[model samples]
Target chain A: MKKSSGDNWDSLEKNWREKLDSHKEEVPAAIWNQIEKKLDEKKGKAVPFIIHRRQWSWAAVLLISFGVGWWQLSNPNALVDDSKMANHIQTEINAPVQHLPNTSTPELEEISSSTNPNVVSHSEPMPSHDIHSNLNQEPRNTTESIPVIEESKPNTNPVILADNRTFEKEKPASLAKEESVEMLIDIQPSQANNQEKENSYVPEPSKKRHSLFARVVKQLRQAIDGEPVDWQTLKQGDPKLENSIHQVANTYIKTEQVVQRTFQF
Target chain B: MSKTLLPFKSEQELIQACQKQDRRAQQIVYQVNAGKMMAVCKRYLGVGPDAEDALMEGFMKVFSKIDNFQGQGSFEGWIRKIMVNESLMKIRKTANRYDQDINETYDIAHPEDAIMHLGVEEIQNLILELPPGYRTIFNLYAIEGYSHIEIGDMLQISEGTSKSQLSRARQLLQSKLKELQA
Candidate 1:
């Protein structure tokens, strides 16, 4: 076998390269069709990417807004304000009931309390039967009852009376003044007896159990009202209330820690 | 039709229009270069629909990667290189499908003057008669003017293998040319 030298191949390559240079064949028109179709396919793919990006941006915005709303609702300070409002209402309702125990003739006290303090002190004292007659007329004029109490309190400290009137006005219109007066009359002694029994009982567990039940009821009511409940406010009353508040606070703290851990992911 | 009347006389303007994806500019560019690019594809692939497929794919690559052509070399040369690479890829795929090696040697007597009498189409037919691997290396080394080392690197073979393949390809072509001349 003979091996060809590089020069022999170089000359052969030169002839082929020159001959092939002028050899141009027309490209089939079908190739352009295929190319155009492929280009269209690529364009189709690009459009969906843009649409998906826009969709993702909208989803991100919605998620951020929902997170902010959840944060606002879960804030503890909003619950504190609701608890304070509940405490104020409780105090006002208890005031009239507390004064009930001091009077023997309840009808006289009701009639006299409704009048001006100066008028009650200065005018001739009304008979017990006449006070009962006034009480019978009281139910007929429920709307005028609150205004009469306001007008009769002129001799008292006006600022305190004005605050009371504003508080009274803030109460729901569905709770009639006459109904409240009747409720006060009915519950006064029972409330007094309950207070005495609560103070006399030295047994810690029974008292604690009772207060815990009351705190749970109150917290559930606050939760229903879309408010945050403050377990700290429940700490001021009974030893049981304090214990229950501490237990609730510990549970809340643990739950919050769990939430924080979950959110970290 | 009115848009087609616009002048894109220079290669720079045409490339810029192609970069901007002007269809008319791309079509004009395709029409101008397709003939020569097809010729380059046919050299490796021979006269077949496979060469046409390679030409379309090569042009598509040219239009897509037109931004990469930095005007350092001739535009036609860059396009020709892409066509050659596309042909090599197609050849590689075909070689894999058949699973044949170019190490099978052919015995032929060298006919020095016979090739000169053969037409270009006859010469192309003779080259296509060689096996895929030999045809690829021969086209790269002889017509495309690549060295044995470059061909070795491109095909992942040793330089010695490329040289041996090219030798066999030349001998086969010489014999085929001698037959045509007779």
Candidate 2:
């Protein structure tokens, strides 16, 4: 038996090592040819493993980033920054409110004036608190079909409105009559109601009660017509009220009955 | 026409070109290491298509993974390790075919003078004559310089089996040496 440490065993390993260290057989040319072909095939097929691994990592990172961005967009209010939210609320509070003219239909004016013809009808601009101005702008062009007084002829008979009220052509010379001036009628509801209101008017409470009813009716009209009540014109009468009332009405009021109820007070 | 006319002056330059996947540099790398790697493969598997396959596969790995070589060791040593691993993989499938009983002993003769006189080809032939299991253990122990414990980890066998296989391989090789001398 050959002991592992025996000289013969040691010599056997040593000789094999010394001889084979310098001994190299010739590799066949076909092997290199095959290897070259395989390298080419591999090059054509894919990138190196390191680059492949890098690309996958980048793809994963991009996918995660996109997922986070999509989540943020889908739930926009969930991550509102406190400072930005405060800035937005402050801006809204400081912004001035805008409004449109509170205009009413000529039909309501004709009814009031015909019932109380002795009520003086003038072309002067109506007051902001004028009950007729409490109604929203009438259904657009409801007054266009109404005949307007001719500015050229001062002596012409007052144009008869839908309510049979005469629209007097008296004018202040400085006020220019615009072709599309919106009309506002000032007429007593009826001789009896006007007398009663004049007698029992308790200035503050009566005016407040009347305004509250007008506001409620305006809201209902707005709800039904899908139009906002032009409260600015309610606070400040139509800026162009001094001009001609002959211009075709621009805005709409859907319910004539609502307009009638609004000013009946 | 010869496809490879190597312009790289140093091994580092060749390795860099291979990292860049230059075909001529790859060919030069294959040409330079193929013969020694084939000899290493043959020591384990003998001269056959299996050795050729191992040689081709080892070079393929070298080119594809060239970027991993960070100048830590000799390039040839790294390649030799790859070739050895490829051979071991080819051997693992048929490992059960030649597993003899450890108790089956051979009377090892004193063939020190004969082993000393043998040429490289004769020593290689002697190792090839061993059973596949014995041949693997002997080549790992003798030529590759792996300890039996390392061999056990590599081949997934017990240290005792590695030692027994190596001892049996040496006894059989010594008997062959004595017969050759006669």
TM-score: which candidate is best?
Answer: 1
Quantify all predictions' global Cα lDDT against the true fold: 0.63, 0.61
Q: What value of lDDT does candidate 2 attain over all alpha carbons?
A: 0.61
Candidate 2 residue lDDT tens string, A1-265: 6454456676768777877866788888888788878877886666575466546544543444344345434544322332234434544554332111122234434444565442223343334344233234353232332333334334533332222222223222232222112222222246435544554323233443245335434543464456865544433352222111111011112233343344343
Q: Name the regions of candidate 2 deviating beyond 4 angstroms.
A: A1-5, A47-265, B1-6, B97-108
TM-score of chain A of 1: 0.25
- Chain A TM-score for each of the predictions: 0.25, 0.21
Local lDDT at A214 for model 2: 51
> Once superposed on the true structure, which residue ranges of model 1 sit more than 4 Å away at CA?
A1-4, A67-265, B1-6, B97-111
- In model 1 chain A, the worst 10-residue window by lDDT is A157-166
Put down candidate 2 lDDT per residue, B1-21, tens digits, no spaces. 133435877788888988999
